[model samples]
Target: MLTKFSITRSCALRKFTFLFLLLSGQILKAQSPAADGKSSFTAKLINIEAATTEVFRYNTTLHNGDAKSKVVELKADLPIGWMISFKADGSQVTSVAMDAGKTQDISIEINASATADPSKYKIPVKAVSGSDTLALNLEAVVKGSYGLTLTTPTGRLSEELTAGSHLDIQLVVKNTGTLPLKDIDLSSQLPSNWEASFEPSKISSLEPGKSQELKARLKVPDKTIAGDYAATFTANNPNGNAPAVFRIIVKTSLLSGWIGILVILLSVGLVYYLIRKYGRR
Candidate 1:
């Protein structure tokens, strides 16, 4: 009777322990997030700041918590004129395959319009697998871009001028970027003894996509050699600089040409007179 009771007690203890373990496992499963049969989309950084001309990159992950594998399709809602793409394993992809309780690493590339204004934009990205959809919100802060372009109104870079005279050139200064340009100073690199001046030597401010007209007075010194010379005109600011090279062709004045003709005629007349007088003697 004692041996039988001991054996029965041992079996009862084992049964109670097994029941307790089974109950504990059920409770733990209920508490686990993955056990809920839900998916997740997460990113270490959801907000980024960059210039309008630069590309925005975000590193993210997609997690599958379901009991089966899934083909997750990725998508993003972006503003018009903006572009977005996804990459997995260094290759461009729109969907990824994930096994149960597995995770996938992805990269999101976004490009805002080059002319986009400086502002904060919201981008909503989603991962969908059948009836399950996981969403993530991303923010992009676009900064201003500074750029300048200096050229003539007619797009001609060459000019002709007479020596010892001044020429008035119309210069068009354009703000080629998305931001305003301020305190832009005008300057030039010319040959020695040459003079250059702008009507408005300094620009207070120029708006994006807008142009300002300025008069550039270029003076060539008297007696300058007749040849093609290079003149570089620059519009400079703290942010950027635009330099334009112009070809200048110098020619003697019409009065000087007439004087040369007279001199040549006089020399010919004198030589003819000398030859006749000396030959007769």
Candidate 2:
């Protein structure tokens, strides 16, 4: 039979050995790095129909024992028909295009008319084979608010008007580019002694291929001069102020009194004298 002290000692030794083994196993596990620790998205633009493409990608990663591993995911954002053109000198801006997700990188071709063909184009090699591999088509559909605009309206003024009269100024604001212009401020530097008033001094918006009518009333002072009046109408740009010019002339009624009658009579008498003398000669 084992003594009580001997039995106690044997149980203590077993417990110590088990604890040491468990600790050693944990240390070894800690040293190993997880194989699947990160997940991210990578995108590349491939030209298919347009100039440039904006691409978005997503990646998912999971780390666990064979049966318990889970996947983390990320999404890709790829726009269609987006393109960028570089300047030859590398200083000046050539061209840039954005797109929605329906398109990849687009091939550009100069048509007989010099317009880019969106339907028949291909992507460049560098864009497709790149590591990102995400294609985005950012063909700008529309940007900013629009109604009707005129790029030619800057620095434009109507002809001079008589004093206290309204001038029908036909200002054309065109959508020179393929964008919309909104809520533009219209202001003017009226000619000296002239008051320029416009209806709807502030526009609501301007879309492509549309126009607005600005009824302007011009008032010239009685003391105004007959020379050209320089009036500058300005539309302040987000970048700078665009300007237009108008001329105004102050005019007066002609005199039809004794002076006018005398002038007519002198002309008639001179003509009669010339006819008589020539006929006799």
Candidate 3:
């Protein structure tokens, strides 16, 4: 039979061997990267604050922590009708090749359609290299797109005009947009040597769904031919601009019109008198 001291010694030896192997395995795992020259990677995403229907920019920074250079591909899943692109050094790119432990700054341009409504949108960003993938989330705040519309109070797009006289026109300027409009400048397109002015050259402020009246005085040239002509009135604001057209019908002056009527009557009376005097002769 085995003695008690021998038995204890055997058990101690077995425990020592097990502990030594465990420590050896830990050391190997810690040094495996340096020994095998394997590469590691890291990716990061940045957030976007806000954007408009107009072209806006966001930025992202990526770092490569591996010992080897890699071509990292980037992509984004955005809302419908939305677009995203990446740029580095002012040139567009779909992916970036970076050296180990190096960082790159990329320009992320995001744009929405003009018809896009005001809301918050979440964008999913991805970076991939081989089997490694990094997922990130971003938010885009879309502000309202403002617009201005200039028209007649009755919504008539045409108006009457005369030469050598001042014609008064009334217009309705409305803020037909999602945001308030301010400092709207009024202007007009007219024939040469003609003059046009508005009562309020610039509006102070116009809220959405609000309308204001503007009186325009147009001075037609004396020599303007009597025919159809087109004139445009525009209201321009920082948000957008609206244009209105008017059809000018240059009518004959009162004096000329009366004279024409008198001539026609005289000619008819003369004809009647000649017929009566020579009918029997």
Candidate 4:
């Protein structure tokens, strides 16, 4: 009951089945080598440390177990608001070819934003060559930022001054950051013939969220004009410096006020005398 057409169809079916099995076996063999190759390598994380806004570098070692070199691509899973860079053998690179049965060194640099949170972070890193993948975990401990703020007790940035007199003002220096600030030197910038000084001269250490009261002594020159002047108070630490501007309003002295009153009175008296003489004529 088998015709020529049936015989041809049977042969076609047999050829198609043989071709499909051969292709499938070849794909499985190719993919299996990569999965097996991953077991021949290891990734190690070393020298991972804490950092602030500044950049921090870490090292990664790739140890090859097979008897051949590998061309691997490097990648990282960094947190939001953070950046990372990679280097190999002291040169900037995104990948490297490791030698057979030897190790390669990679440098990783991580940078966080200024407003990033101060806490511990675990970033994931990976190296891949084809389907062979090696994973690593990097631990980063973030150090808090260093900052300080200077202001007056009453929050007023201006004060009145009398010529030839002494003025006393209180200022509050607060640690407005996460780290403890030490050796904060206080200084002032004033106009000519004016003097200013801080009570303690410098701060030993200002803890986080803590404030200290400081007395500022100011003396105005006798020949100063009755006008506005600008004064600057600066707080400097090892990290950086902060500046606060204070407006100074100089007023006339008591003697000057009395002299002006006497001059006005004499002018009024002369005018009254002149009017009386003219009316009599």
Candidate 5:
């Protein structure tokens, strides 16, 4: 009878221990956080290609996995002469507030140097909330930018000339871009019966931030009326073109002015004589 009682007590103790362990495990699991609850930073499009003159944009998301809200700061490592900004909900911001298990959309805007060479650049970005941090890598492929400016050395686009005479005006062509310009042809549009010619009418090549001086010869017909005329000068290439309008004031010659005075005097004398003779008759 004693042995049977001992055996029964041992079985009951084992069952109680097993039940206790099972209940403990269940309680621990209920209190523990979900495995999927973790902070993350991701970008929808991490790479882009554009001209150096354009602004680059990247769309991204920041997620908070903690059970509490937090403020996440945004930052980036950029090249020299570059600019960067972060935007959330169409407003510029340096940081964002995110709720637990929630996500926030972000827009990154970057501006590369106007003189940046054509190449691929890597930009590392980060989002930090207290002890936890997330990172994302981005790329920008810059392309060549072409630009030109046509003007005069003094920035004056006007000149005076005598009728039936030719005038030489100095002009400047500048490469106002990040890349070299080649095969640039110079041309002009003049008034009817007027003529224009350019010295060194074609430029083989022009480096960035460089300027070349040339001369434009303009000729006006002998009978062209004395007035202000419009002329357009153009510098064109396969990549780009620039046009400048110049005001050309045409004036009669000094000799022509003297002849007009003489004619007026003669007409007055003739009129006076005719009036005197006719009145007497």
Candidate 6:
């Protein structure tokens, strides 16, 4: 009942089966590497960055890594640990377009946080722009544990800085937080009806334990109203836009004051005569 031929054939078959499995594994090993072994995941959202004025905006776009027609849903995914800030002032609607049935690129938004640098306060965007629908949770947060404290610029302005006068308004941006401040953006609002220009247009950067110099040119009109005026300002790093308001007080020259007086007199006389005649008593 035991034939040597049959037994030999079975053994041969078993050997071949073992060889096949071994070779197949080698082929798979040569083909691709496991993602977890060396690849890194996409960046995740931690905080919502924002601009002080709603008129300004921050945005970015992403593409679906898949090559075929795939359904993609976009959402914001916030990191577990961070101080998040949410304000309704930054709600500006937007739209994104993609190639039909092809690449998947979705736009992501970084919102403004309550405490962020005024100049570089930008939120990094991360979302699943892939074949699967994604629900992302995003929010705003300050930069460091001991975040930068933005001081609102405060000071007294000069009265009627003469026309073509060098306009140097001193402002103090202090480090109110445990951490330091750097790369600050200092901007001043011109008088309501006044035209002025800054030497640098903008102060590029500043660090904690330091104060920066900024100056502008105030060109008064020949008929400029010489009196007290004020302008709002901001000493900002991207963290947040703190308000710096200053008083600009000025007085017209004697010749200019005389011209103003003459106009006032003529106007007062005209008004008085008109009122006297119109006395419908």
**lDDT by residue for model 3 over 1-281, one digit each (tens)?**
99999999999999999999999999987654332233332224344444354665666677676777789898889878888888988989999897766667777788875556678777777778888776667777777768788989788777666668888899999876657899999999987788999998899999866899989998988778788888899999877899998887887777767988999999999999999999779
Show where candidate 2 strays beyond 4 Å: 1-158, 237-241, 255-281
Output the better candidate (2/4) by TM-score: 4
- Highest lDDT scorer: 1
Residues 1-281 of candidate 2: C-alpha lDDT, one tens digit per residue: 99999999999999999999999889976774333422222223222221212221211111222222232211222225333332212332222221211111222221111122224333221222213232333222122222233333454444755544566565655433334556677777875566767677876666645666565566667555456667776665452345666655655424424666889999999999999989787
Tens digit of lDDT per residue, candidate 5, span 147-250? 89999999999999899999999999999888899999999999998999999999999998899999999999998889999999999999989999999999
Q: How big is the positional error of residue 66 in model 3, measured in Å on the Cα after superposition? A: 2.9
Q: Is candidate 1 or candidate 5 better by TM-score?
A: 5
Winning candidate number (TM-score) = 5
Which pairs clash inside model 4? none
| Error of model 6, residue 13, in angstroms | 78
Rank by lDDT (best first): 1, 5, 4, 3, 6, 2
Q: C-alpha displacement of 179 in model 3, angstroms?
A: 2.3
Pairs that clash in candidate 1: none
lDDT tens readout by residue for model 4, 150-224? 999889999998999989989899987778899999999999989998998999999877999999999999989
- Candidate 3 at residue 95, lDDT? 91
Separate clash counts for every candidate? 0, 54, 0, 0, 0, 34
Against the true structure, what is each candidate's TM-score? Answer: 0.76, 0.39, 0.53, 0.54, 0.81, 0.35
Whole-model lDDT per candidate:
0.93, 0.45, 0.79, 0.82, 0.92, 0.47
Q: Where does candidate 5 have its weakest 10-residue lDDT segment?
A: 29-38
Compose the digit string of candidate 6's lDDT tens values, residues 92-145. 323233332223223343433333344433333333334343333334434432
- Model 1, poorest ten-residue lDDT window? 29-38
Off by over 4 Å in 5: 1-37
Whose TM-score is higher: candidate 5's or candidate 6's? 5
**Order of quality (TM-score):** 5, 1, 4, 3, 2, 6
lDDT for model 1, on a 0 to 1 scale?
0.93
